[model samples]
Target chain A: MDYFRQAWAIAWKDILSELRTRQMISSVLLFCLLVMVIFSFTFDPGAEYVSELVPGILWVAFCFAGTLGLERSWGAEQENRAVDGLLLSPMDRSAIFLGKALGNLVFMLAVELVTFPLAAVLFGVSFLDVWGKVALVAVLATAGFMAVGTLLSAITVNTKLREILLPILLFPILVPVILAAVKSTGSLLQGEGWEGISSWVKLLAAFDVIFITVAILTFEYVVEE
Target chain B: MEPSLRRNLLGLATFMMIEAAIFMIFIWAPTEQVMGIVQRIFYFHVSCGMTTFLAFFIVFLASILYLWKKDKKWDIVAHASAELGVLFCTLVLLSGPIWARPIWGTWWTWDARLTTSLVLWLIYVAYLMLRSASRGSERRTRFAAVFGIVGFVDVPLVYLSIHWWRTIHPVVIKPSGIGLAPPMLYTFLVSWAAITILYFYLLGLRIRIGKLSEGVEELKAIQYSGV
Candidate 1:
């Protein structure tokens, strides 16, 4: 209970800061919207195959925008040596990791919330029927993404190539999450119900469990000097 | 034995073994009835593939030890092994398409093994890049160790996810365990053994280079400090 409270407190700190400035969320949201517009131009949005392309486009947008958000999320801590303060806090290092990951998850999901409906409208697909299923897939994939992203973000924050290094280190390991998410979302959008997407859901769930565990275990090493 | 003598012996052994393996592959092993001459690339390709996996496993083990022991030696081993892993992985990726273009009639198909190797290649190349980017810090070593472990742990998951994804794409190559003839099997064994030795030899060379650089850095530090 204490650990959960500590983690929540740290998450709330980030959330509250974002609420005050709205800098990270707004930029990430706008970036996601731009991705939608650019991708929409590449293919005929009215074409029959547009539905098939929507999931991949949606995931690409999420991942790219999520990468941006991740950089800022850690980059914020770098300012004023704030991460040092976090380190000096009484909470466990893994708690800090959990908190940061949770904060990232919330921010990315918020971006997804606005982007999903906008994507449906722009691409001329009615995700209205499968909205819940799509949301489920998004949440699962984003959770795993955040878990890994948070860890990698910490690792990259200290590197010379801080911004570029995250994606290079991140995307390969993230292939499974992206593949599973896109598959699940594609199927769900096609009106394939729970039974059709069950396997992908399992993969996403397994990714979430494995990576969150690994991140929690290794977070201490990344943050410690 | 002296370190130089040991290294020379290892180098000699690797050279002789590789020569013997090449001779066996080209002259001794019977050509496949189906794929013909192109099938021979399979000997080195598969051997390199195995060596790639072995190199990565070394990175994983050394990474865990690095974190556990907090030893610079372990970090050097992990970094050196990751570089060698990327090298072997590149060989696998290159030879794969060379064999595939003739046999499968495509330069690439999203086959499970092909996709997994590509992803693995990307992962370790990123590992090496991370090491280079974080050149001079102890923190860099720790971060690299963390990624080393994370990257390796992701490999099987990457493979499993890709294998499942390949079910939707019509699998171009069924990977039905090519039935090796007696001589073909012997040649493959010899090639595999030779490549494994080459990996170790290359790894030894890399580790020596890493230690020498560390020594140079220490000497420079001492000179600056007037110690």
Candidate 2:
């Protein structure tokens, strides 16, 4: 109960600050919107290519935008030296990781909420029909992304070339998450329903579980001096 | 065995084995009825692929040991293993295309093995970059050890997730596996053994060099400080 409370407290700390400033989500949403618009040119509405390209565009937008958000989130912590205070708090380190990851997930999902509709408009597709499945896929994929990204963001926050290093360190281990997400998104966009995408969902879920566990267990070492 | 003598023996043994393997490969292994001379690239290509995995597996074990013991030696081993893994993975990525351009008739395809290996290669390259980025801080080793462990864990998941799809790439080892003809199978085994020796030799040399450099740096620091 106390563990949950501490995790919630840490998450609340992020959420409250985010609500006040609005910087992280705004930049992420705007960047994603830009990517969607530029990519939509190739995706010409109602073209045979648009349907095929939508999945790739959507995921690339999210992952790229998500990297920006992750950098900001961890960067703020590192720059302010707040992580040291958190480390010294005598709280459970895993709780700290969970809290931060949860905060990242929420912010990413909020950005995705705005990005999806804008994507539909630019690409001239009606997401109303499959928004639920799309949302499900996005949520699962986002969890995997944030789980790994949050951990790596911390890992790289103290590095010499963190901006470039973050994506380099991230995108490779993230290949599976991106693959499953893109595959599942392709299926959802095709209107194939759950049966067509179950394997990918399982892969995403498995990746989420594996990565979250690894991240939490290893978070201590990553954050420790 | 004495260190230099063992190394000399290893050097001689590696040369003899590689010589024999090369002979078996070029002479003993029969040409395939289908792909012909170009198919022989499979001998070294697949060997590099298998050894890449072995190198990464050592990295995984060494990484865990590094984290558990917090010993710098384990960190060195993990770093060395990752370095060799990346080297061999590059070989896999390179030789793959050479073999594929002739066989698959294209420079590349998004086949599962190829894609997974590409990701694996990228992950370790990132690992090496992270190691390089970690300078003059205790955090460097700890950060790298954790990253190494996580990267190692990701390799199999990357393989399985990517392989979950219907890949056009041939599944060489299948459910009804071990389908190699006698000569091809023997050539593969010999190549695998020779490469394994080469891998250990490289790993040993890298670790020794790492320790020597660490000593040199320590001496330099001491000389400068007049301690």
Candidate 3:
């Protein structure tokens, strides 16, 4: 119970920081909107291609936006030296992972909230048809990406080339996650019945479980000096 | 294991010569009842592909052992094997397109084998980058081990690709499967044995060099630290 409270406290710290500054929100929102606009230039908005490309384009934007937010979370921690203070606290280190991951999830979801609806408008896709499945895919994928990214961010925090290194290390492991997410979302959008999306859901769920467990266990060594 | 001194003496250079001879023999070795000299590529191409799989398997084993023991020696073995695996896999990729060009009538297709090889290449490229990017010795070793273990996921995916997708590559030798002709089968088995020896010899030499370098570094550190 206390662990949950500690995790919540850390998460709330991030939320309050974002609320005060709006740094994460504005950049991610603007970046996602820009990606969508750039994509619109190349691919026609009125054609049937919108339905086909919406899932891929939205996920790509979310992925890039998520990276932006994640970098801010750690970057802010570095500037304030808050991670050292947090590490000095009595709470379990894994809780730090859970806290930051939950915090990242919230920020990403907030950005996605705007990106998804706006994408629907710009791309001429119906949000009413398969919004549930789309949301489910986002949740699973976001969790998996955050779990691995949190671990890699800590690992690379001390490195010279961290900004570039984190994504290179994170992307290959998360390939399976991204592939499964894109496939499942495309199926849902194409109106393939629930059965078609089930396998990919399983893939994403399995990846999330494996990665989250491994990250929690190994994170101690990552943060240790 | 007893050192196979005599066996190791017959290195990959010798076996490769034999492989080349057998390959040329395909032109003079007589045409098959069905597929012609074009079919001869089956021997070298398939054997190289199998040897690459064997190298990667060694990498996976060495990686697991390195993590378990926390020993630098195992890390060297893993790193060397992975480099060799990439080399063999690259050969398989190159030779593949040439054969496919004539037979499949295109340079490349999105076949299971081709996609699997490309993904496998990308994963190890990431692995090499991870090792290179780390600063400290211990840090690089640990990161390499983790990447090595995770990278094995691509290995199984590559091996089972034909079954998972209807690959254009033939699945000639399944364990519970049918047999092959005497001439082609005999030459292939011989070549496989030769290539296996070559992989071990190369891996052993690389590991030895790595240990020597580590030793020199340790001596230099002690000399400078005044310990």
Best by DockQ: 1
Q: What is the lDDT of residue B207 in candidate 2?
A: 93
Report the lDDT tens digits of candidate 3 across residue range B124-172: 7666777777888888777676667656743443334223434676668
Which DockQ values do the candidates obtain, in the order shown? 0.85, 0.80, 0.34
* Candidate 2 lDDT, A67-92, residue by residue in tens: 99889888888766888898898689
**Which CAPRI level is candidate 2?**
medium
- TM-score of candidate 3 on Cα atoms, chains taken together: 0.86
Report chain A TM-scores, every model.
Answer: 0.98, 0.96, 0.96
Model 1 residue pairs with clashes: none
Sort by DockQ, best first: 1, 2, 3
| Top lDDT hit | 1
Cα displacement (Å) at residue A222, model 1: 0.9
Model 2, position A5, has a per-residue lDDT of 89
lDDT of 3: 0.76
Every model's Cα RMSD, please?
2.0, 1.4, 3.4
C-alpha DockQ for predicted model 2: 0.80
Per residue, candidate 1 scores C-alpha lDDT tens digits across A1-225 of 999899999999999999999988888888888988888889865888998999999999998999999998989999999999999999999999999999999888988999888888888888889888888888999999999999999989889999999999999999999999999888888888999888888989999999999999999999886
Native-referenced Cα lDDT, model 2: 0.87
Root-mean-square deviation of candidate 3: 3.4
